[model samples]
Target: MKPAPFEYAAPKTIAEALDILGQNDLDEVKLMAGGQSLMPLLNMRLARPSLVLDLNHVEGLDGIREESSGLRVGAMTTKRVLEDSDLVRSQYPLLWESTVAIGHAPIRNRGTVGGSMVQADPASEYPAAALAFDMEFVVMSSAGERVIQAEDFFVTYLTTSIEPGEILTEIRIPRLPPGTGWGFQELARRHGDFAIVGALATVRVESGLCCDPRIVLFGAADRAIRVPAGEACLEGAPPSEASLTVMGDAVFDAVEDPLSDVHASAEYRRDLARVLSKRAMSEAMSRAS
Candidate 1:
């Protein structure tokens, strides 16, 4: 199938892009980033838009910038660029790991971080990373720009707080605190396949006790679910097998209503979520020591 007829717009500046979007909104317009996801949907006739504002030509939104706060990535940055950046690998190892594992070489080459994120796939690893790292989304519309927390950005399945005529411009990742260690784990059918269950655990151990540990789980619900119960179980507990078990159990118990896809039943996914949470937490704790 081919996409329905649509007009295209290439804006040179951020303001220009937003202006295009604002104008097209009057006629049901859509924004096109890398076209990795949108084009497929267009080809399959799943989405028919009257206008597509191509953001590729938009300026100042395609590189990584390091700052005192953390790393700020342009929305147009490709997955391949992220995976290859030494700065990203050393500073934000969790982000690098997630990028490398998402899709394969070709998909990574064309897929943009902003696209994957705004696409808001429930099983996408980046959303979980954003939540774990406490990332921020910088969005703009004709109304002007404002920042939103990662957790609050996702409103529902395949839906976000990004409103009409708004576009995501950058993601702000804060610098990791001293003694912080991060780990990412996923259970997938294949090396690059979407995870049936995914876990991201960051443990900061201070003075031989768990402190500031966060275990955020994805691929288990309509959106990413942060297992606060698991993190709480580790709080003030000694880094030992018993604490680990309690943490894992808490993560399993946290998911009261998990989704059931044809690939995996809710029961099996819940079990994987438990095991992966435990394993990921153990590894994260080890590095924190």
Candidate 2:
């Protein structure tokens, strides 16, 4: 299938892009980053926009910068760039693992960081990683820029808090404290396939007790979510098999409405969530120690 007829614009500057967006009804204007996700939808006629505003030519929106707080990543930065970044690999291993897990090398070569976050696919790794790391999304429009917390950014499947006419410009990730350990796990049919279920965890062991533990899961809900119930189960608790089991049970119970698709049943997804949560937490604890 071919895409519906649409006007196309390649803006070299964000101001130019914003001007175009302001003139058109947002529903009729679709923003194109890397086109990895949107191209398929366009080809299928699922997205019938009157205007496809391409951002590829836009400058200054594709790099990684170190900040005192942590790192500031441009939204248009490609996944391949992220995967190959030594700073990312050393300072944010969890993010590095998640980046490598995305589809294949070819897809990563063109898929933008902002594109995946805006796509809001429940099975995607970035959303879960965003929540686990408490990342912040920076969006811009004529009104100016606003930062959205990860917990509030993702609203539902294929949906986000980004208002029409707003463009995602950057993602802010905070630096992990010393001795913090992280883990990422996903179950996919193939090595590069979308995960059927996935879990991400972070832990800091203090005096033999888990401190500031976080557990996030994707492919188990309409959006990636942080499991406070699961986190509560592990907070201040010894990083033991028994504690992990209880935390896993909490994570399983928290996923009340696991997505049911042809790939997996709701029951199966919930079980995978439970199992993966335990494994991820165990790995995080081991690394923390």
Candidate 3:
């Protein structure tokens, strides 16, 4: 079915878009950037907003920039640009590796980083990567702007902390210091399908011991699950087969409340988590070494 009849506004500037959004009842207004996710909802009549505020024509929301802290990507930047970016590939290999697997080339051409994060699909790759890297989001409203850490931005499956009147303007990724190693792995039914289970591991090694290691799991929880128990097992320990074995077991046991769906059973997802955790951590450690 086609979407319900709605007014469409394509604003050329951020201020204009904000003004349009602010003037309407936020619940009745929906923001459309890439429309990669929203269009399907609209086509199904799942989202029947009164006004669709399109941001494609808006200026200042389509570039990648490097900052003293890290890299800043405008909300409207496409996934394909991210995948092809040399800076991203070199400085943040995890980001590029994860993004390159998001979908087929055409899908990536139209999907935006902000759109995917705001969609908040539990199986999404970007949100999992964001959590793994401690990324930040900058949100704007007619009133002003505020920054939100990735941990707090994703609230639940298909939900986020974005207030109705606010727009996610940019994503900020912190620079990984020297000695950082990262790995990303996902299990999907097909090349471009949503992951059945996905894992991201980042390890920083010093003096032959792992430090500040993080393991993030997705497709097995309401949101990306950070495996603190897994990290704890690896931290301050030599990155060895024994440590990885222990960490993988801890992560498998620590997985809690995974929902069962047609894609897989809870037990199966747990097993995947256990297996992928070890694989990712091992790859990451090898890179760091």
Candidate 4:
């Protein structure tokens, strides 16, 4: 199937793009980054926008830089770039792992970081990683720019807090503190396929006790979510089998409504959440300093 007729614009500058967006009805305008996600929808005629604003030509929208606070990643930066960055591999292993787990090399080469975040797929890895790392999203519009925390950014399946006229510009990832340990695990039908269930964890071990643990689960609900109940179960607890079991159970209980799809049943996803949570937490604890 081919996409329906639509007006196209390739803006070289963000200001130019914002101007075009401001002049049109936002609901009729669709933003395209790498076009990995949007193209499929367009081709299927699921999304028939009147105007397609392509951001590939927009400058300053693709790069990775280190800052005093953390890493500043441009919205158009590809997943493959993140996978190949030495800085990301060494310092942000969680992000690196998540990027690599997303599809194959060809998909990674064209899939943009911000595109995946904005696409807000429940089965995608980045959203779960965002929550685990407490990342911030920076969005812009003709009005101005604002930062949205990960907790507030994701609304539900294929939905986000971004306003109709806003474009996600950058993602801010806080530096993982020293002595922190991270683990990422997901179960897919195949290695490169979308995960049926996934879990991400970050923890710091202090005096043989888990400190400031974070557990996030994807492919188990409408949106990737941080399991505070699961985190609470591990906080200040020794990294013991018993503690992990409790954490796993808490994670299982927290997933009130697991998504049921052709890939898996709700019961299966809920169980995978329990098992993966324990495995991820155990791996994180083992790596903690």
TM per candidate: 0.97, 0.99, 0.98, 0.99
- Sorted by lDDT (best first), the order is 2, 4, 3, 1
Give lDDT tens digits, candidate 4, residues 11-97: 998899999999999999999998988999999999999999999999999999999878999999999999999999998999999
Candidate 2 per-residue C-alpha lDDT over 1-289 given as tens digits, one digit per residue, 9 for 90 to 100 = 9999999999998888899999999989999998999999999999999999999899988999999899999999999999999999988999999999999999999999999999999999999999988899999898999999999999999999999999999999998888998888999998899999999999999999999999999999999988899999999999999999999999989999999989999999999999998999999999995
**Candidate 3 collision pairs:** none
Please give, for residues 1-289, the per-residue lDDT of candidate 1 as tens digits. 8899999888999999877776655547878888888998999988899988889999998999999889999999999999999999988888898888798899899899998889888788988888988989999888889999998987767788888778899988887787787888998898888888899988888889999989888899888878888899999898789998988788788887778988899998888888988888888888885
Error of 3 at 11 (Å): 1.0
Assess candidate 1 and give its lDDT: 0.86
As for TM-score, the candidate ahead, 3 or 4, is 4
The residue pairs that clash in candidate 2, if any, are: none
Candidate 1: pairs in clash:
none
**Which sections of candidate 4 miss by over 4 Å?**
none
TM-score quality measure for candidate 1:
0.97
Displacement of residue 206 (Cα, Å) in model 3 is 1.6
Candidate 3 TM-score versus the reference: 0.98
Q: CA lDDT of each candidate?
A: 0.86, 0.94, 0.91, 0.94
lDDT (C-alpha) at residue 124 in model 2: 99
lDDT of 4 at 197: 95
Cα displacement (Å) at residue 138, model 1: 0.6
Distance from true location, Cα of 161 in model 2, Å? 0.5
lDDT of 3 by residue, 46-81 (tens): 999999999999999988999989999999999988
